[model samples]
Target: MTTPTIPGFTRHRVRVDDGVALNAAVGGAGSPVVLLHGFPQTHLMWRHVAADLAADHTVICPDLRGYGASDKPAESGAGVYAKRTMARDVVRLAAALGHDRFTLAGHDRGALVAFRAAMDHPDAVSRALFLDVLPTLDMWGALRGVSAAVGFHLYLMAQAPGLPEKMIEAAPEPFFAHFLDAWTRDADAIPADVRAHYLAASAAAVPSIVADYRASAGVDVEHDTVDREAGNKLAMPVTVLQQDWGAALGYHARGLWSAWSDALRHRTVSCGHFMAEEDPRLIAAEIRALADR
Candidate 1:
């Protein structure tokens, strides 16, 4: 299967951990910025925004480990796919590419990783833009009643491992395509070729994908709880763009985010969950605004 990449960007396979290498598209040159793709997608989601940012900033879009062309290590232990681990992969990936620190942007699952990074390695993430997600702790706390059904995939993946992986791998393409079709505002946002690429990549990484989500249910929450208890917070300037899931879920997103970040700008956007793809210009503008501040 032919994979679509950001045009004019060069690709890199940089080793970030033992037997793990992340595939990244790197382009432009100035201050550095790293774009992390969310679940059911690869770095291709950032194609439009990355191209636009490349004019003045060095943009690095990497397929997070276990998602796209990146290596998918076994769950190994509960810690393997933890957001802490994934966040470290991001930091190491940036360091390997000659960036000691960089502005951060992540969508969906990637947003969780960016949140962990900002809290754990404050010195490494100067600013952050999180798209359409709450922190793990806030997410679980908010999913109280019927409205949580929209996140059935999370419950499915958070199961005790074997079952969810078997069920998803049984019909991987359809399973992955369900979100690709359901989570976007514009049908044309993801072109046919790009859609095919996402399905193929996601289908190929079912086990690792399930493990990643499984970690969220286990070790990730523990890590987040520790931070919350310790009163740890994000030191960087942070901007969050999200669909109005908060209203339906019975939580105040701005309040939750404000607790974690000293400087937070939360916007309730009209776009769908895949905002970077559906509204790339707005996403890019928000990233630039936060990064420049």
Candidate 2:
């Protein structure tokens, strides 16, 4: 099957592992930059940012594993969609593209996977940018009573057995679109076709998507715990852009982020949850700054 191509961007599928084929879009030429998309969206979320970066850098955005045109496998208990596994997929994808070391940036769910990538393969990633999310351990720890309710999806999808898969598959569009619409401060920023594509990709990958979330509640937490106890913070320069959700929820955002990295530059964007899509120029500028640093 032929993968759909976005104008001004060339699409390619590179096999990262035995069963995993990642659909990636590459453009421009200098220093590679891999952009990972968050949940309920594919690499398509990077369309605008990729276009801008492609003018100066080789912007590679991939549909993570089970999302978008990438290969999808049945949910296997032996090979769950843990962040480590997903991060490895990105690492292999970069090597396959001849990028031994590259800058990494991700938003939302992708940011979580990027975090794992930096943690597991610090040598491969030169710098890191995480948008609109706290580390998995900190996120879970931040929850308290009603304030935690904002992140209901985390707990909901982390259920036992196959309940989340079954429930989400039944009404995937609403489940996926709810966040896309609710989290954005400006709805018109996302075009109709792009929105439909996001819904389609998300709806088709229900089981794997749920597995990714479930891992966060299980294996991902274990990994983060070990890293925290070992005091293994990100060695590379780190920049975090987020809304003041911590302040809104009565927690110190800067203080929490400072605990995670020694060299940290943090900012609060006025935009809502989908910062990359809603404000690609700013996102691209921040990534460029990270690359330069």
Candidate 3:
């Protein structure tokens, strides 16, 4: 799949461990900072913020495995798409780029991967930022009534493997476009060309994408449960930008994140789920703040 060129950024196919080669956009010259994209979109989602961050820091935005031009390995029934594995891919991707340690940020699905990467390899992540997401355990724990109804996609994608994949493959555009349109407060947040690219990329990666979501319901939860039981918190400074799901779901949003990070800065943004695209300046400023701290 072809990704639109981000001005001033060079693209590379960096091979991480497990034979996974990630399609990454690399630029900048200072401290290393990796930006991970979420579902239904490639690293292109970070175009604006990445460009801004590149002015002062090394900005590396990579298409997560099973998305965009990245390798889509078949599921090994071992939760290969689990955030733990995906997180490892990020760690190795950074190391391959000669960064033994780096600041990190992720949105949506990528946020989960960032969270895991921080938890599992605390030494490798200097500071972490999560955009519009909750821990797998908190996510499941918070779902009830209307919240559960709105998150139907989570359940739909978590179903038995073949069915979800088959259904998504049947009508790729509408299925993929649904999230882009529904999640964004402004439909124009994603332009026509970018939306088309997302739909096409998502259609091609149906099986792997579904597997990623499937792993969330299984192995991802198990990992989170273990972390919770162990009383482990992220060892780095963390900043979370969310959509005030707590207000909508009748819970405390920032309070939820505080449990997982000792150094926590959580705020609810007014943008849609695609906060980076909707408000790139805020996202970039937040990352810069984390780096400054």
> Which ranges of candidate 3 are over 4 A from the true structure?
none
Q: lDDT per residue, candidate 3, 42-113, as tens digits?
A: 999999999999999999999999999999999877567999999999999999899999999999999999
Ranking by lDDT: 1, 3, 2
- Report the number of clashing residue pairs per model: 0, 0, 0
User: What pairs collide in candidate 1?
Assistant: none
List clashing residue pairs in candidate 2.
Answer: none
How well is each residue in 1-293 modelled by candidate 2, as lDDT tens digits?
23335558887889988877998988888998999999788888888888888888888899887788888776676345778888999999999989999999998889999999998899999999999988998888888789888888899889975788888888999999999888999898778888888888789888778878888899899998999999888888899999988766777777887888898999999998888888989999999989877
List candidate 1 segments past 4 Å from native.
none
TM, every model:
0.98, 0.96, 0.97
Q: Which candidate, 1 or 3, would have the higher TM-score against the true structure? A: 1
Look at candidate 1 and tell me the lDDT of residue 260: 92
Error of 1 at 254 (Å): 0.8
Q: Evaluate model 2: give its TM-score.
A: 0.96
lDDT of 2 at 45: 85
In candidate 3, where is summed lDDT lowest over 10 consecutive residues? 1-10
